[model samples]
Target: MSDTDKKTVIVFTDGACSGNPGPGGWGALLQWNGQEKEITGGAPDTTNNRMEMRAVIEALNALNQPCHVKIHSDSALIVNAFKQGWVDGWLKRGWKKTNKKPVENRDLWEEMLTAMQPHDVEWIKVKGHSDNERNNRVDRLAVEASRKFQQS
Candidate 1:
C-alpha cells in the first residue's frame, strides 16, 4: 500500500533502569496490519526518563517514511510532555520550563521532536505494569535489555 493508504501504525514503548541511573534500556513494539517490529537498546549508565524518551525516538526513527502513527507509552513524563504542551512551551522558551529551569531530557526530547516531525503521531498513555499485554511485553523487553548491562 502507498504511504498515504497505509494503516495507522500502533506502537507500544517502555523503559527500564536497574538503579534509576544505571543500566537503563528502552523497548518499542511497532505494528501495522499483521506486520510487527520490535526494537530495543540499552546504555550502561543512563536515567529512566532518558530511556523512556529513547524508546519513542527510536520507534519514530524506525518508520520508513511519514505516516499516521499512534504511540502508547506507560510514562506520564512522555505523555504529558506532549499532550500538555510542555514540549512546545519548552521549545518556545529555549528549552526551559515555566520556572526557567532547563527541561530534563532536553536532548532526547529534541531528538524525539525531530524524529516525530515527519509523521502524524498521536500519543496515548497507558498504566504501567497493568493488564495491557503489549505494554507488559515491552516492559519485559526493556527489563531484559537493562539486565544485560548489569555488572557481571
Candidate 2:
C-alpha cells in the first residue's frame, strides 16, 4: 500500500519517572477518523527515556494496519534520534554512541524501529509542560501511572 492510501493517525505521547532510574510510565493518545484510543503503562524499574520510547512503540504497535503517523512528543531524545539521523548513524556504527559506549535502551530502540517499519512516521517535538492540552493530559496519565508504583 502507498502512503496516500494509509490512514492518517495523530498521536500524543509522554513519559514520567519518579527518579532518574526509578518507577516510570508511558502514555499515548491516538486519534484517527474521529475515533480516539488511549494507551498507558508502567514499569517498576525503568528510566524516563525508556518510557518515552515505549510510548511511541506501543502506540504504533496498537495499529492494526499501516498508517501515516504524526507523533507529538515532549522527548527530544526520541524525536532527535529520528529527525537528526542518530538512529541511522547508530545502526551503521554497530549501535554504539560517539564516545564508544554502548547505546542505552538499544533493545527498546530496536523494537521501536521494528514496530515503526510498517508505518510512515513523522516525529514532532513539543515543549514539555506547555499549553498543549493533549500533551498535558498524556503527561498526567504517565505521572499517575508512575505514581501507582510509588504508592505500592
Tens digit of per-residue lDDT, candidate 2, span 90-133: 99989998888889999999999999999999999999999999
What is the clash count for each candidate, in the order shown?
0, 0
**In candidate 2, how many Å is residue 118 off?**
0.4
Instruction: Compare the candidates by lDDT and give the number of the best one.
Output: 2
Name model 2 segments beyond 4 Å from true. Answer: none
TM-scores of the models, in the order given: 0.95, 0.97
Error of 2 at 128 (Å): 0.6
Clashing pairs in 2: none
Q: All models: lDDT? A: 0.92, 0.94
Writing each residue's lDDT as its tens digit, candidate 1 over 1-152 gives 46577559999999999997899899999999899999999999998998889999999999997788999999998899889998889989999999999998877887898998888889999999999999999999899999889999
Q: For candidate 1, give the lDDT of residue 140.
A: 92
